[model samples]
Target: MYIPPSSTSPSAQTTTIMSLKTALISYFTFFVVFVDLTLASKHHVINFRSPTLYPESLTWDPSADHFIVGSHRHRTLVSVSSAAAVDTLISDLSLPPNTTIVGVSLDHHRRRLLAVVHSTPPLPIFNALAAYDLRSPHRRRLFLAPLHDPTTDRPIANDVAFDFSGDAYVTNSVGNFIWKVTPDGEPSIFSRSPAFTSHPVDQSLPHSFCGLNGVVYSRKRLPPRRPIKHRQNVQSQRR
Candidate 1:
């Protein structure tokens, strides 16, 4: 004769239901947290619609509430807004024809915009850092400092960074060094290292010859009052 199986006790059934409830709660909590994270990490995109204008670098202007972009093809500094409005902030006739405006830095304290202008390949003749008056009604050209290193055959000024004392440091990609420019528009080699040349480059990559493309200055990293000996000690330790 066949016998029926025993049913689960009431307590066991209650425990099973509680376990299922706990699992469902955990799944629901995870789903909510995942959705929250997805929403929090979402970002908005702003599209700039100039097909010919190949912009190389951009910096935000807090005072004007827009972005200042340097054009590689048009050789102009353009102001782009979040609303997709594109306007030429500066169209410098002083720049050589067909030259590119690679890097731009805005000095809010001095009310000036510094740009790196250079000629690419075929004939890389000109390389300079040009400054423009940001507050001027006509956006007047302040100064242009030629960045030519005698040792570098084809020095390309790739990027610029301004220090607290209104001095500008420009990077030479081909020569792998930095050029320092004073407020009076005097340009000189600031820093160079054998390590820059020693860094191995991938032969398969395009423009593998280029080095030291960008630069930045931080006051906090090395305080002005710090002793030279201390700085030397730090450098020696790092080496």
Candidate 2:
């Protein structure tokens, strides 16, 4: 008596209903399953386990055909396969023991994985942008650039975006700014705006201190400006 969400024909509807029935029976039998209805005619379910590994950010690695996820609780990066297998990809020893991995970005062109690492408030100690060599057998640590100055207020390095020129931009949710890391691993504040500080009128809202959580880069070019001759003509007419 189950109904499908959408179907193009009666036969398709019947198939979907049967699939749901089977999935329900499996679920009752103690199997973890979820129906993936990304495609109208196809259904797939994936179940993965990583005890106490609360992931915060995930990115697809097309070359590996799997997902790279950053752990919020474990301070590690792991890869999840289609078959529900999990493998630790990066766990740097240099980072503070209490820090968490917040964001992950894959630079396929440069064969590197970028990550944001920071400690939460109440005694925040570490904040940095880290990189790993994806092509290396050991997944070697490429660099770790601290995003905040020791004299400044503690900032939470949250997420990252990579540009075509090999520059990595990281967001500071606590400081309301962005950090730019060069290809050679130098870190500097890239951007800040007064608008980023403006908050909702409702002060009771949660997590109001957080700002600039995510970032992205676009490669599109702007239209060319009009020729100088056109401006000269207008100025002469004004005279």
Best by TM-score: 1
**Once model 1 is optimally superposed onto the true structure by TM-score, how far is the C-alpha of residue 239 displaced, in angstroms?**
31
Q: Which 10 consecutive residues of model 1 have the lowest summed lDDT?
A: 1-10
**Residue by residue across 1-239, what tens digits does model 2's lDDT show?**
64446634888877878988998897866532333333354755768999989889999999999999998876789999989889998878778876889989999999899999988766457888899999999998889898875434777889999998899999988778888999889999888888887665455778766768989888988899866798789999999
Q: What TM-score goes with each of the models?
A: 0.76, 0.73
Whole-model Cα lDDT per candidate? 0.89, 0.85
Instruction: Report clash pairs, candidate 2.
Output: none
Candidate 2 TM-score, C-alpha based: 0.73
Task: Tell me the alpha-carbon RMSD of every candidate.
Answer: 8.2, 12.8
Off by over 4 Å in 2: 1-45, 149-152, 198-201, 222-239
- Candidate 2 positional error at 54, Å: 0.5
